[model samples]
Target: MPILMLIEYFRATMQQWSFQKRNVAAEAKRTLTPWAETIIQANKNACNNWMVYPISNSRFVVKSFTHKSVVVDFQQRTCTCSRWQIDGLPCGHVIKVLTMSRYKDCSEFDFKAYFIETLRKNYEESVNPLPSPLESKIPGDLMIVKPPMMEMRQPGRPRNIDRILSQGERPIWQECSTCGKFRQTRSDCTSRGSRSGISQATVHIQR
Candidate 1:
């Protein structure tokens, strides 16, 4: 499914699950468990560090939350810890300090957006083409010896519809007479129930 469709499905599910309560405070009080709050606080704390400071207009200096020994550059927004690069989110050390200082509401800009922009810029810089002379030089020696390309195999065996039609498909479910629920059909059920003199209307599944 498309991302937009998936997002809509999630929104619909959330709306269905939301309780029909009038007061927002009442809803929060009912839903907010102590354990949930602790987890939220822990996640917030993970994104902070003392070394984490906005160094200049575009740069920030930080240290790794996972590895205290490894310092980092938040301006370039990178860390020795791969988590920063993999997820492109502010690491634990940055998050912890940001929560502590309450820098989220600051007038300059949102730190989250700044952090994302830093990673985006880094990705853009990596994809930018090199100068023409250097680009041609790197591929020249490698492309000289042409390796023989292997032939790719086609997909699986073709269907034999005639053979399939010869073997009839089995019925999966039988409708229950007593209740509407589906039950496995037994060949001897009619005889067995008649011998026992049980009311067919009240008959229950053997299983």
Candidate 2:
């Protein structure tokens, strides 16, 4: 009976894998058409000057006018909107800046700069490692008492860690707008906040 069950499980797993592969292939074929220009136009239509805020020491915040609920960080190069992170392209507000400035071919639009290598290299030469300058020697006359090790207690509550952030994960770096420093994400920026903020431009999309 056990042998029969094992054989049936194997057959079922193979069928599921085959079905999944076919579905993925079909989806790929459907999405292969050129759609960048269409998406650019759509973004232009919905573009608005969102409020930019410094979310943290290194992050900026932006709020949506139409939706009235989204926050964005220009430093982190992230928006509360789901589309930008998923697509690896600038969001509508970002595209608005590109179009307005007439800088479609600028460095800001280069998607590769957002990755680990180029960003790290931008600041690499500035960071130098040095050993501690102070030297200290243990005093021979000082007596130190060793405490007994207590029984190991089970950890209480687990720390709330962002699962997506792991030690093994490399940073996606971006160039700092203020200091010209390259950093791992915009959050590593060293520039102080500016009182002058970017204005929102109104864009109309064509049908």
RMSD of each: 23.7, 33.2
lDDT of 1 by residue, 39-111 (tens): 4456566554445656555445555545554444546666566555654454555454455456652212223
Q: Candidate 2 — which residues are off by over 4 angstroms? A: 1-34, 48-60, 97-207
Q: Which stretches of candidate 1 lie over 4 Å from their true place?
A: 1-41, 47-66, 96-102, 105-207
lDDT of 2 at 167: 59
For model 1, give the 10-residue run with minimal summed lDDT: 198-207
For candidate 2, which ten residues in a row score worst on lDDT?
198-207
TM-score of each: 0.25, 0.28
